[model samples]
Target: MNTRDWNETLRSLNVGLPDDVERLKAAGYYEEAIARIDAYLAEDWTKTQNSPYSQGLCPHMDVQPENPTPHGVDVLRDAMIAQREIMRRIPAEYTWSKADAIAEMQRRVKDFTPEEFEMLDRENRMDWRFVEGEKRYQNRFASTLIATHADLARRQIDPPAQPDSEKERCRRLHEKMAEQGSASARITLKASVGMSDEAFAAALAKAKAEGRDAVHVRAWLPLPAACLSQSDIELEEFTEEPTVIAPENAPQRTVCWEADLTENRSFGVQYSYRNTAVYTDPFDTPSAPEQPDFDTEEQPSHIVFTPYIKALAAQLTAGITDPMEKAKRIYDYVTLNVRYHYQPSYFIHESLPEHCARDRRGDCGIMSVTFITLCRAAGIPARWQSGLYVTPDEVGCHDWAMFYVAPKGWLYADCSFGASMARRGDETLRQHYFGNLDPDRMVANSVFAAPFTPPMLGFRADPCDNQTGEVEADGVGLYGDETVSSKELVQYIEE
Candidate 1:
């Protein structure tokens, strides 16, 4: 629905719905009910502002939030998701006119190199134009953010990404899997953090004297979500017995332990799981799986359909028919065209895909959103899955896309990973991501904007999704406030 419809419906909501249908007699006054919602908790917040789901640029809106008791006000939350989506697609008004664009070059592009100007000209391609103040204006092209802005110069740099050898190996593995159905063994690995080696040794020595391994430490180890690619889930050992173990499929999978410092020398956990790669050739697939959520668009946020997105989709898939092929075209456009760069926090922007399209350079999450948005626009079912990218070397937050094609199941598209190979001119690796993904993934959050098992209070640090687990002590969230966290790949076992 359009933003206007959302606003009108929001303005005209029958806010008087009683908690129980039988209680309607006590809540018949619609105006008073709306006033109560608006003035809820003595705050005169607007409907968009009346949410705790998300903060900054997104609506904390769910059609039905998981409340133990049914609140009569949830109908309003559902409508607000639509309204918030409308707000996201609001055009980039007053960004820049032709004159302003030229002035921006003069100001930001030190020495105004002819080469840079030409690059900017190419990026513009007249994609961004909106009427502003009796004339049309153009937003500046993304070229201004060239690498290494120092000493009044912007030097270009090769795209930074996963190591070349590891990336190529992953692609080759997928190719082998696709051709021969050879499978990668699920790895049994260990993860841990926040303990000194010296302290650990001292505790371990004491535990050994007592014929034990526990040295006493507190640790939170990531627990993997149950996935077709992953199995044999186990948390073999810990410094202390786990006091908090998140559900197997929890949004941010974690198992926490607060063992006495003597119970275990190091705060750590050992677990093992296998990972199998998926490979598909789009043309070989004739249909999509009957998954419930993949068939629909994500809510009134980054993935929302708007006039701008709709037009862009039409332009991108002008003659595409086969769903798999259409999805491929979108993937090609992104991996082939978009530059990979670290982007600022996503919450600062109105829409992620729109931002990526306009700017042309963003990290994995941006590319994932862009791929998902365009694929959905082209009538393909695509969704998001992201978490830690655990290799033998490093573990860091990452995101990727899943487009469904029948017989092939859900195909993985790692545009960022593909873009990395494209930068190195590796055609095989670049194209592999369209229908395959390396098994080096910990799928923590399966869908974007999924709720936590136990809901959090206040705006979560990463409101849209959980990357690492979220933690709170004494009922106060620790993210973006007092606590910082990281995960390391202490071990990687490959068969």
Candidate 2:
């Protein structure tokens, strides 16, 4: 079959490699087929070998520009050889198992042409309404599951207890949820003014599935007196409002760290030949190699990031108490507890909880991801936001979390950096991180693993789950040293 036919077959089967490669091999173009495969493999080598942090003129190492790093080139070469071997072995035979296809197709997409990948992204992003709705859908999806899981985990730790009063019982449930790490969890009361039956169903289904560990009602939003009277569902009477915020009506903000030049001055103006390595963007995936389409029903991961910003949501209620106190509780836990590491250099389908279990440390993305996971686990709605940190002289990449805390709206939290500052004994960085943020940054985009509303014509160059930028035909910009300006942030900015 011709290339077109082969491509059609592969497309129909949802595989990444072209059918021509297989046919060519069977057609006895042994040398020619190997050569073709080698060419395809070459692309993989080029894309996969580069770290998001590689610096200097020739970011990919294929062509050296005026400024080149010896260390960077060495890494590029090593990755090139490694990926070349991986590409060489992709069987030309098209055995289309969904499980196998999902795995292998992801590989092919990663290796596919950047333009083609962009096109796929564009196709997915054509509908704006879908994209916005996905944000809301994502919010509900996270709240339901996280609440369920937290409740499950809580019940696993503490069974329901009989108390002297209904209020006591409610207090016991709240305490139980917190002990099991569901401190941020919330419950929907049927007496709420604007709550819908659909939301109630979703919450109920989730709680039942999780065995009802962390459940509560907004003080102003009273429990359906009828439902409470009928069922053994413990009732709690509160004279004062709960201090926590709910996810639905929270304010969201982005905090940028302004890079100053004083600290970035060259020490003795030194230059040395150092070897470096180029790694792909951690979120890069072959299947969705193009930019993401936020509007598409085809979410990148079935395992979505859930945000539990219930503390923020508490303020939205009419008769709520102590909003700031609740917010402080959340800010403290995330900023103090979660550790940040630079490992897990790539993104996968596993949720942040899974990542936390495996790698104790992660960079900003994973930290923000975990924040979302925890917030959702607590019944608070949260979402992702990432972009470049623009200072006077340099642009560095950053990621942080935003949660819906009703009265205050969607508030921004940068816990990863907050944790870092605390470790370094920088009280300013730690203090400014929790509720307030530094002013020297800009948000290029927000939302994690979310596709650009209007997809590009082809798939993205690296389309797993991340924010990306391109400086050259083949170079993929990543976090750390690979940043466009790198540490130069200190050189350009005055303040």
Candidate 3:
């Protein structure tokens, strides 16, 4: 085995070594550190199993491995087994306790009907578990299942009245925006796009408003990148005058506002931009690899080049010479291999690429980051861009990647969107996403980890993508304090 492999394997196995070796590591002398570790293992090989080190990673002598580690045999075995589980999705046993059930029985019996309890037990299992010495725990997704699904949300907890449908809430917010008469609401769209916008607003306003969650509506709704794809910019209206409007070109542009937030108030902005669909031919040779900006480098937390990423990139790009083609291979692999699903929020992910590789399932952001890490490992420069997927119908946050190719400049790839198309066997749409994107999108973030203009008050629900604007009141921000900002379409002109 090469010295690098030994060092990486040892590090992965969490083997302990001496201070000088640590100094070598501190100096980034991985090869030298591995060599020293190897020599130590060799000298102490026969005696380590009999010593106190036997309890830990006591390296046995006369055992040679391509991946060498001094960890005890049993320790290494257990570590490998746990690593195997952690490195991939496994059916882990959820331990619920009688104590936990007893504690919640009164509430469960009071809160659920017999049929409702059976329905909850079906596929959408409530996320409840007991930890040793701790109270039974449940998250919002778990606790709100009844309210979110069973229609008891309004009755269960006396929430302020909210628009029942997303469409209605959005329309109400737009009405409030238009009511405020902000400077932003000046530009209007063409007949088609305008009609879409108007219809959306009216429909949202007219929907069957149901279980309400719009508590004290404090929000900063994202605005389009004006002087770009969208045109005829206007600030339709507002609930209250915003503290600020982040610059037209702000990485995460927003109509920042704080309001007294009377019940049912929706604060929003209105703007229209032309959709300019961008495309590139992957068969075309790409520009040679160029040095990436510091922001696009190997961020240890999310995009670090671990051994698995390196190996995967190598396997995927083998025999590919062209950077563009190599990038395409990685993109294709990601879209094809990583089935898209709603990930458990962005904060829980440590190394997104590794998580993607292990779990084999994640949302668009997961697919984007995995593609970024692999392309970077394969020596292709790629970065992140994300925002809202604006349409007359649905508006939600989305993420995608951009890889630089000479002649073509930077091109887009939407693996999640593409994967959805692939599932339909829509070759045209699927391939289109590999090298193009619909103009019907808004970019709020040009780079991941891009800082907010005034900086957020505290932990953002989504620290990566900033399509849904943030909120703060009194002092620090409320993580999920109020309604998420939304959009409406008055018109959409194909031309």
Best by lDDT: 1
Cα miss at 405, model 2 (Å)?
1.6
lDDT of 2 by residue, 1-495 (tens): 111111111111112234665465344344455566556545533333445424333445455333344233433333333332223322222123323323332443333344532453354311111221121011122122222233322433233353354223324433443344222111211111211334334444555576663222211111111110012222243222333321211121111111111111111110111111111111122222122222222212322322322333333232523333333455565566555544322321134444452444455776766666555544455666554343333345677766655444455667776776665566644654554333333333344543322221122222223333211101111222222222222222211
Error of 1 at 74 (Å): 11
Per-residue lDDT for 1-495 in model 3, tens only? 111111112123332335765566445344455566555544544345454455675566475333244444544433232223222211122233434533343354345454654465454345433233332323333343433343554345434455455333334433443344211212222110011233323333434253333222235666666533345455555555677778877777766655442233445555665555534466666364564443346754567788999999999988877777888888788877776544454543446789788767677888998898888888777888787775544566788988876666677888887776666566666676776666557666676655566565444445566766665433323333232344556665544
Error of 2 at 104 (Å): 34
Output the lDDT of residue 147, model 2: 27
Leading candidate by TM-score: 1
Candidate 1 segments whose C-alpha is farther than 4 A from its true place: 1-164, 188-222, 239-244, 256-269, 287-294
Higher-scoring candidate on lDDT, 1 or 3 = 1
What lDDT does each candidate get?
Answer: 0.59, 0.35, 0.55
> Where's the lowest-lDDT run of ten residues in candidate 2?
266-275
TM-score, per-candidate, Cα-based: 0.60, 0.34, 0.57
Q: In the order shown, what is each candidate's alpha-carbon RMSD? A: 13.9, 27.6, 16.4
Candidate 1, residue 408: the lDDT equals: 69
